[model samples]
Target: MIFCTYTSLVSVTHTTVVDAPILEVYSSLYQKYGTKLTCPCTNIAIAQRDFITLIPTFHQVCYSDFVKKSWLSYLNAASDKYLSSDFRSQGGLLFQILASFCRLSQDTIKNSLNKFYSTRFISNDVLDEDLLKNQSRSHIETYKSTTAREFVNSFNNIRDAISGNQLLSGFLTNFDFKPSKYSSEPQAYLVSYVSTVYNMPGRCNCDDTPSCIFPASINDNNTGHVILVVPGLYTGCLLVEAMRQSNLQCLYNQTCLNEIKKHIRSSVSFNSTALSSFVPSRYNASTDINQLLTELMVESWIENISHASYYNRCQPAHCVYTIVGKNNAIYIITALLSLLGGLCKVLYFLTLIVVKIIRRRRGKIVSIKFLVGMSEIYSILTL
Candidate 1:
């Protein structure tokens, strides 16, 4: 399960148009939460702990938006200069972006796996095999084969549990807050924030028109539901502004545009239905902010867990080292020592056997007392 922990701005904006004023909600949030709500990485030490703990799950992890953005910027720069970027072509671009960015972070990618997952879950043998791989793709896939798929499958079960009518009943009883406690507003401005650090080719702009040309088969009904989830209020406004700034007025030829409109209408219809399911509650911005924080925290936790698991499986360099790091180093030394010790023992035994055979060949009467005395002497010499 890809647990995305984007800024809470995405969720807040994605709702249908609310009956209450938008500023009211914003005011409530700032008053109650304000800057107090920051990324959980506020404390460097805690962040490190979280990083170490979650390293095993993400084979291909990107810790900072800065790194992913840098790669994206480089790809775009190459494209603008008509130069062969790290990704030679459109296909290459997608693969590189996914390999480099995606879920796994750079810091985690750099460290040894054994250190992250702990020795209990991994061993020396596995670490050696993992570090042997050169490319990021192999590392990512290996991790998935080991970790991601299983965790996602389990998360699916949790999601399924919350899907049916049993969700509200159980949620209300167990949790401190409920979605129903919010304002009785019928509409939410539904927005969806796609990851901004996109390195895909042919993705020059996010204009509604450019979206029409995307190669992914667009369901005629699905086209209109393209809710752009921006990272922040400023970003959202910038997105719309960029659409206007870019002379990309003609969305994917006229035919694609028509299809896109159809998709948008269908999406609106779907959102209307989805929005209707939950009972509306009285609006209290502070309460809503709290709820949003809760949702973000849960998402961050899940993403961290799933990503760490994937890393362990992916063995993206650092992950493999985390496992066998100290133990593997020690194991190699131990093996050498054992081999040497065994060799000495074997040599001592061979020496004794040779001495006895020589005495026998000399026709000497090898009495039991003589043999016993010889054996004792050999043992002392060997020790």
Candidate 2:
């Protein structure tokens, strides 16, 4: 069995409750500010950017507003209860109220910047840059990476819930507040949700173990169902945005490709027989007729004199027809001398025949045996 210990760490469960009704809050965030307006950070309008940014800002702003309103109201409610009744009687309740106040205060501050990003006359780009810096600073101050991530994650959750209506349905419980069946399932990033939240950067790797098992929810609403609905989209668009930046493409491809190259390099091996089949050539001065003929018989170059093989291999063929060597010159001289000797023998035979014919015409008897002897001598001369 392949035990996946890392898989256990994925899809972290988080729950938070706002004082307002969940549907009303969801609608206020999603419906009201979903339209593209002028950016708070820049002079350019929201229409110039992408549609994904538009809706998420809605959720961010709404959540931020909710944080402020809910926490204050919760505090006021606690104050009235404590002041109206005896403090001694309600001291235990006071602790609970104070604890709620602390939790909501932190949540409110986080939400405030996010809300501001979606609103008013400033540039979205500046707001985003500021938010990242703020988050980083907060992370340093708190010395808690997980909480720091949560601060951004909450806003990201809202982004996902809006982009994937199915995800919103899964994350948000019915008015009766029944836990969804998938609530126990792990949290993973959603492609469309992440695209909307992060401007369609790199893809989500939901199957990645351990990190995938965390329970996903928006504002800690419907954990499991929400993850299943939207996949890997994180809050704040930080991870996706970083990946989309041009400088990191090489690193991104390298990380994924290195594994394949490693397996190939490891499996390869050299074979001695394959190497031994090829040998380097050495020049030979001595020429043996038998060896030359044997080599010519088997050699592809000699057989492919018309250079058919050169075309097959996509090369230009230019054969050298001249032979230059001491022994080669001797053979050429011998052939030339032999041709002259044969011509001389033929001329001497013709002269002798004419002389015999002339003598026979003058009434002298010609000797057939003598003629035959002369013919044999000419043949020898020809050789």
Candidate 3:
């Protein structure tokens, strides 16, 4: 009975063969067990690149001719008298900064990926689509936002460091500290004013006055040559401010390009094609460099999650579940019947033993009484 009960009441594990696509099986498993069940992976050290893909797009300027040696060389060789002459050196510097920003953005994203694969993922551990997607998004946004802030702060520091009023520029071009008659003003005053406006944005300090900047003439008009002023370019107190405040729409306008080409001695080498907004890009032609810098100059990025690969890596042999024996009607009835048969057999054997003992005792007592009666009769006859 004890053996029968033990066999009947024991719990069992059931395995159900999954007969669906791998992705479907994975989804079903997640739905049933969530993260609680462990699916051991055949390839435990799965590379993140196998399951995730990332592609980044950088600022258009980084891809444009402005940063190319051919274009800068052409600018240098072209007539210095043209309005866009300053573009030869200043444009180079600006785009260099842009290229640097793009590199840092790429590096930061790479590090984030490394960190993700190194720390976040456990290959054999069960994973769900939502969990993976959310994790990817979190890492991307965290790195992007953090790097963007840092990139912008770096520019701000550069901006503040070169102000015409306070920093190196101020020392070079001193302001008139005291009131003086216009006639009595020293030649230094004229030199200071001209130098202030002539250097970069030349007009005002961006920190003290938001509207202090204006488009610098393409050519130095102070050189007594006729200044050629481009339509959309400006020079601010700092090169960064100039990029932020100025619009690049002129670079996208055909007429503007034509005007710039006409001023240059050679039109053949000049980049006559306007900036294209049609090319799949995150930023438009009018988006200024300030916004570009703040965004770390990334035009776009691609994210892909491969559930198939994940499933393949975590290929489960079968689904296993345990069923407890309690409250099961069939098991209960079978166990009870087995216990009843065992108990009846035991009771019958006990009854047989008890009957044998009673029969033996009764026989012995009868015999003893018979012997005593005979002896008494024999004594009476002798007397």
Candidate 4:
């Protein structure tokens, strides 16, 4: 027993606080402590901008001449242009929708930023950089996914009402049809109205759905009943539908741009520059406008996050942890002496109890033997 030494474990805690720039603090704490260290934050509420940065790269169509007023108005004023999908009569509406889409996409993203910032964030800890990034990414993706789904439903409603119902036809009912500078005959105005508004003659009259409106060329206003399907551009029941399905793939080629440039009323030469699909974008040149709209017309989204910023915002008061430690020589010696004292008291009590029990049993045996001897002596005396 003298050769052996008594050992005991003592729990000890070490705490340290580093004062540095946000990025440096995060790097140092993460590298040194791994997960063993923790610091409770003095302030937990942090602005989202401190931890998250997101930038959306919009599609080239939004910036191209297609959406610009100069190009659209030029196409609209072309006297020789007869294709409605060429941005002639409905150019204003097309421009309106495109402009609205661009503005609304940005506004929605702004709202998302503000809304996310409004929420509370604990940061959990300073070293939880991965956790913070994942949260921000998830938040952005959720907004994008929700916006895409909602846009699809809303656009479908508009398309359905324009083609299958009389929802939009009522707006033109009160307007007087008159002769335009393009044509002296007021009847030409009527023909244009039916073609542009109803998409086809008698298309305005519908309980559930009107007749299908195919693309047509307006060589002469007198031929209202005739349907002409124009080549090189798409046209359907509504111009909006055509635009949604359209892409600038043709403008990429020299020949296609040349043919289309014939109708453009620009005095200057219109470049055949195409929308670039080579950039790091989720969509390609031939991707439909509707598909692009699903992504808010954003070619790409870039996110930048810094854990140092998060740690600074957290501003932990202290780092707290426990360490497994062996007792010192003095403490071990004291504990060993106390253990020996307790063991001695316990053994003494046990020995006293055994002796007492043995004495009581021996007295009982002697009493029984004495009673038997007395009985035997009485029986012998009587004999």
Candidate 1 TM-score to native: 0.17
The per-model lDDT (C-alpha) reads 0.31, 0.30, 0.60, 0.60
| Candidate 4 lDDT tens digits, 277-365 | 56566666567677777887787878887777677778876665444466677777787889889989999999999999999999999
lDDT (tens digit, per residue) of candidate 3 on 1-383: 56556666677654444433366766776687665445555555665666767666776766777656676566556544433325433544444444555566667666765755454345554456777677667766775687678767876776655543455332222222343334444443322332244334454544464234445344543674545566666554455456566666776777876766665664337565777777787677767767877776778877787767766766665443333334456766777888788989998999899999999999999999999999999999999
Output the better candidate (2/4) by TM-score.
4
Models 1 onward score TM values of: 0.17, 0.17, 0.63, 0.63
CA RMSD of all predictions? 31.8, 40.2, 7.1, 9.4
TM-score of 4: 0.63
Model 2: per-residue Cα lDDT over 1-383, one tens digit each = 01122233234333232232232343343343332211222123332112112111111111222124443343334232222122222222322332333354345445643553343232232122234345434433343234335544554565455434423222121111333344324664323322222123344332221011121112212242221211221222222221111111111233322322222222222111111112221212122212222221111111101112111222212211122223344454565567668869998999899888887875433576678889999999999
Q: Which segments of model 4 are wrong by more than 4 Å?
A: 1-29, 79-96, 157-165, 169-233, 264-272, 325-383
In candidate 3, stretches whose alpha carbon ends up further than 4 angstroms from where it belongs are 1-36, 40-50, 79-124, 161-203, 206-212, 219-232, 266-268, 307-337, 353-383
Instruction: Point out where model 2 deviates above 4 Å.
Output: 1-238, 246-332, 364-383
In every candidate, how many clashes are there? 57, 30, 3, 1
